[model samples]
Target: MPTQQEIELQAAAFRRLQKHLMEDRTDVQNIDMMNLAGFCRNCLSRWYAEAAAEKGIEIGKEEARELFYGMSMQEWKATYQTEATDDQQKAFKTAFKENVGQE
Candidate 1:
């Protein structure tokens, strides 16, 4: 088990990553991220929702997305999202299968 301080440090790092992705790097598209990193903002939000379920706190997907993105998904899509190319979509399918498996 990790120490309390270590857990706090990890939490801080996670916050930094979230801020970096959500605010500092809005130019990064989710499909590109998923294709490259095998995870994207949607994946993070889904993980958050799963964690909440583990803690007995109910949160829907859109709610989790809003919390993670700091806005409605529709708003975020309108403002920052771009259409993915066919190549990106193909890569994303492979990455998602490799990293996330079937669910």
Candidate 2:
């Protein structure tokens, strides 16, 4: 079991990572991230929702995304998202299947 201090440190690390992704690296395309890392901001948001579910808290996908993004999906897309190239899309399909399974 993790001690309380460890939990706090982990939480802090998560927050820093979230900020790095959401604020510092807005230029990083989700498809590129998915292809390269097997996960992306959307995956993070989904994981956040899943965690909430485990705690008996209900959080829908869009809501969780908004919480993690600090903005609506549409706004984020308009502001930061870029169109994925064909290769990126193809790689993303494989990566998503491997990392997240079928949906």
Candidate 3:
């Protein structure tokens, strides 16, 4: 089992990464991010919702998405996202095949 301190440190690092994704990479499309990182903002939001459910907390998908996106998800889409090109879509399929169920 992991030590409490290690878990805390890991949680802190995850927070930093989440903040960077939310604040610094606002222009990066989630599809591109998933292609590169194997997980996108929506994946994070889903995991957040799952965690809440595990703890008997009721958080809707939209609530989790807003928490991760730092705005309404639709607002984020309208403001910073572009439709993925064919190449991006292809790369995403490859990435998902390589990364599925690893997290």
Which regions in candidate 3 have their CA more than 4 angstroms from the true location?
Answer: 93-103
Note the Cα lDDT for every prediction shown: 0.94, 0.95, 0.87
lDDT of model 1, residue 18: 95
Per lDDT, the best of the predicted structures is 2
Residue 60 C-alpha lDDT in model 2: 98
Worst 10 residues of 1 by lDDT: 94-103
Candidate topping TM-score: 2
lDDT per residue, candidate 2, 1-103, as tens digits?
Answer: 9999999999999999999999999999998888988899999999999999999999999999999999999999999998888888789889999999996
Determine the backbone clash count of candidate 3: 0
Q: How big is the positional error of residue 7 in model 1, measured in Å on the Cα after superposition?
A: 1.5
On residues 1-103, what C-alpha lDDT tens digit does candidate 3 reach at each position?
Answer: 9999999998899899898888887778889888888988888898989999999999998999998788998898888889889999988888877875533
lDDT of 1 by residue, 1-103 (tens): 9999999999899899999999999999999998888899999999999999999999999999999999999999999999888899889889989988975
Clashing pairs in 2: none
Candidate 1, residue 11: Cα displacement in angstroms equals 1.0
